[model samples]
Target chain A: MPYGYVNSMKTRPGHRDEVAAILTGGADGLRAAGCRLYVVGLDAADDVTIWVSEVWESKDHHDASLRLPETRAAITRAMPLLTGEFSSRETIIAGGLGVTAG
Target chain B: MPYGYVNSMKTRPGHRDEVAAILTGGADGLRAAGCRLYVVGLDAADDVTIWVSEVWESKDHHDASLRLPETRAAITRAMPLLTGEFSSRETIIAGGLGVTAG
Candidate 1:
């Protein structure tokens, strides 16, 4: 089954741009690690927030991505900019454009 | 450009199933109106919450979707079950799976 994660995070005021950069810059790396989707978005209501929607080949791949040294490095760079973790939702992809139904 | 929206919501206790049903049940209608992605997700932290990730052909298409009769009906049916609107982020799809970059 395809695994997915949907989440939003709030950074300190003025850190949104930095966070977006980090997230996007890390995209190719994530994709190389079997991430099918890594969408980076700007919150419409709050300028300091960002959203991420990701789909991975499997839940195992999603978990394994975190252990990659490059990912860990990116996380370290981004950790300081975050003010709070807003919310996260995990799902099993049923079927859609980017994913195949299992 | 491909337009996207990522958001998560909290429903009144015990209302998640109803909300997911309404959202997914209306998927075909949304697709008919040019919606390319409509991912429904359940929150990991809160059982009563849900997440939605949507992609439309254009920002106009996304806006026009709200005016669709079926879309309006679904929204009306869902409004009562919601407890809070948590977050919404709007994005220009740069490039990724499921979308072609312009």
Candidate 2:
């Protein structure tokens, strides 16, 4: 099974757009880092919340991506704008339309 | 843009599989109701969490589905097993793979 994670982050008041940019900018980079799917979306109900839905080859691939310099830098940049409240649910994707079983 | 929603529902101790079944069984029903894509995944970090990521033709289509007899029936069947606690984030999907913009 592929590793999937739904990460929800709350951005400080007007910083949601900034945080979104950081995530979107890193999207292509993530694809190069063993990511099968990476989606960055702005929550409609609340302007402060950002959602990142990811599908990776493995949990190790996800962890390794975070350790990369660019990934680390992006997180650092978005941290200051974040409110620190988040709902992260990591999952072992069983099967899905775009996901390939492992 | 397609309307997208990420819903994280919690199942009581051993009911995750049961809830998953209901979600999967309703997958076809959802498509019949204008669901462009529906993915059900079980949380890895926690066995009780079920993540449903959806892409709809419109938010109205989603709301309408809930009103459908079959969809309502499935929801009722899964209710008893659900913990009633969930994280639902609705978004305006700005262009992602496999989604057709409206």
Candidate 3:
């Protein structure tokens, strides 16, 4: 099974556009790094909360993408626009799951 | 700003209840580690997809919780019932974001 990661973060008020731009600019980099699926969704009621779902071929591939200069730069640019601290966890894919196949 | 983490994973078919049990069993461990808000929400249309949102006092606290034996055991028990791979990213909290006080 392919490894995947879900990253959710809340943007500072009025900074949603800036945050979205940062994410969009780095989409290619993520795709080039073997990201099969990448999506950014906003909370229906609160525009500031953004959730990102990404699927990579493997954890190594995902790690490699993070080391890319472009990815690093994009995150750096987004730092100031983050409203609350973000956290994440690494999980192993153990059957019976599927996506829409992007 | 409070550091929060969202961990999303998909359960094996017909394993939604099991997944929730695992999560519930570990709730105390998370809360004891300074997790202010911990919620497990299943996708509206898909019961297999589960999303967990937790707010911790800091990343260190979150990290500490992960290192605990209970947390490790809980995850290990849930591994076999996992359907798809999970992914996560760490982001810094850099203003204007608020959550409903718990």
* Interface CA RMSD of each prediction in angstroms: 3.2, 2.8, 12.5
Instruction: For residues B5-102, write the lDDT of model 1, one tens digit per residue.
Output: 98778899998888877887876777888887787766656678777788888889989989988889988999999986677778765454444535
lDDT by residue (B40-85, candidate 2, tens digit) is 7798877898887777888899899889999889888999998899
Candidate topping DockQ: 2
Candidate 1 residue lDDT tens string, A1-102: 678898778898888888877887776788789888777766666678777788889889999999999989988999999986687768866554434535
RMSD, one per candidate, in order:
3.6, 2.8, 13.4
| CA lDDT of every candidate | 0.77, 0.78, 0.62
A2 Cα displacement, candidate 1 (Å)? 2.8
Model 2 error, position B66 (Å): 1.7
Question: Candidate 3 docking: what grade?
Answer: incorrect
- The parts of candidate 3 lying over 4 Å away from their true place are A89-102, B1-102
Put down candidate 2 lDDT per residue, A4-92, tens digits, no spaces: 88888899999987887777676667778888776666789878987777788899999999899998898889899998999777887
- Supply candidate 2's per-residue lDDT for A34: 88
**What is the C-alpha lDDT profile of model 3 across A1-102, one tens digit per residue?**
456565667888999768866775566667678775454544444668776545667779998988988888888999999977564444333311122111
For model 1, the stretches where C-alpha displacement exceeds 4 angstroms are A84-86, B9-22, B25-32, B45-47, B73-102
What is the TM-score of candidate 1?
A: 0.72
TM-score of chain A of each: 0.93, 0.93, 0.82
Candidate that beats the other on DockQ, 1 or 3, i.e. the better one:
1
